[model samples]
Target: MNEKLTKEEIMAALNERHSPEKQALLSEGRVAIAGLGGLGSNVAYALARIGVGHLHLIDFDVVDITNLNRQQYFMEHLGMYKTDALKSLLLKINPYLDIQTDCVKVTEENIVDLLGDEPIICEAFDRPEAKAMLVNGVLEHFPEKKLVSATGMAGYGSSNTIRTKRLMKNFYLCGDGVTEPEYGNGLMAPRVAICAAHEANMITRLILGEEEI
Candidate 1:
């Protein structure tokens, strides 16, 4: 039979991968991710693996067959609420993480309330309008918090174009910043994950007090 590792052992393994300073910062940082599809799901996965201390995930949708193409969810998770499913998966990765999830739709009126005092905001909505709403609302209401967003991650290849950009003070955007899902071109796993990685990496950098590019 396989032996189960204790929480201390699990944390020891994580600390080996990250420096004490980096791990300390990550373990103290709190990030809120809006939406739980391709971008949000993947970003959350990456952050959890790195031992981010707290995550506030908000998503009003449920897993569907279509999400299997690019999202982090599995076939078994189909039909479950995205927030609940993601929370389950993230906890499996790091049980010590402090995760708070909201299964309600994020709106202009409730964005700040849902996100609370988290200093990092991740924008992971798939629709253009929804993305704009979260970005605008957060920037307007919580200008001090850093906002990392994704755009134009559809299609495959051309991975180089997916980059992290400091759009303005306290605002960072990832992806090609142009491509959109259209005829013949659709969202795929590779590009979406790349964008998600960019967002996750930027979040890590900000948390570590590294200079933003």
Candidate 2:
């Protein structure tokens, strides 16, 4: 007779594909994401699947029809706050993950508080201004924390241009590093997810004390 799988067994099976050392590192790492749109949603999902134990998701926006294109959300999540909806999805991926959501806008005055003391920060905002604000705020106020941000993930083709660069001590930027959203190029799933993957991978590397790519 086949044995029934317990919750622990299921979790072990889910994580059996990863090396024990990497899995242990991920389970002890905590990261805070500054946005919950295309980049943030995908970053959180990737980290959760990889067994990141704690995630702090900050977003004040609600799910809209337009976000269905590339966001890690479903139509059923429409009208729901991004943080709440994202938390629901992430938990389903790893039920043991500690996901904390803040449904509030991140501003210069409150960015530090919103992000908390998480050692890693993921800047996944769609707007240039918001991204800059978070990066600047972290660099100036929380220099001890490592930050990963992205730029120019818009448009299609030339996906190879999307690269992760170590900007400064404890700081990294991903994407083509030039394609601003206003270039009349539309944002699609392929490139956006590519950039998010870069950010997520960098975070994983940082957690494992691996050299920057």
Best by lDDT: 1
Question: Residue 161 deviation, candidate 1, in Å?
Answer: 0.9
Q: Which 10-residue window of candidate 1 scores lowest in summed lDDT?
A: 1-10
What overall lDDT goes with each candidate model? Answer: 0.90, 0.89
Error of 2 at 212 (Å): 2.5
TM-scores for all predictions: 0.96, 0.94
lDDT of 2: 0.89
Q: Write candidate 1's Cα lDDT for 161-188 as tens digits.
A: 8888888889999999899998778999
Q: How close is candidate 2 to the true structure, as a TM-score?
A: 0.94
Report the Cα lDDT for residue 176, model 1: 91
Worst ten-residue run, lDDT, model 2? 1-10
RMSD of each: 1.2, 2.4
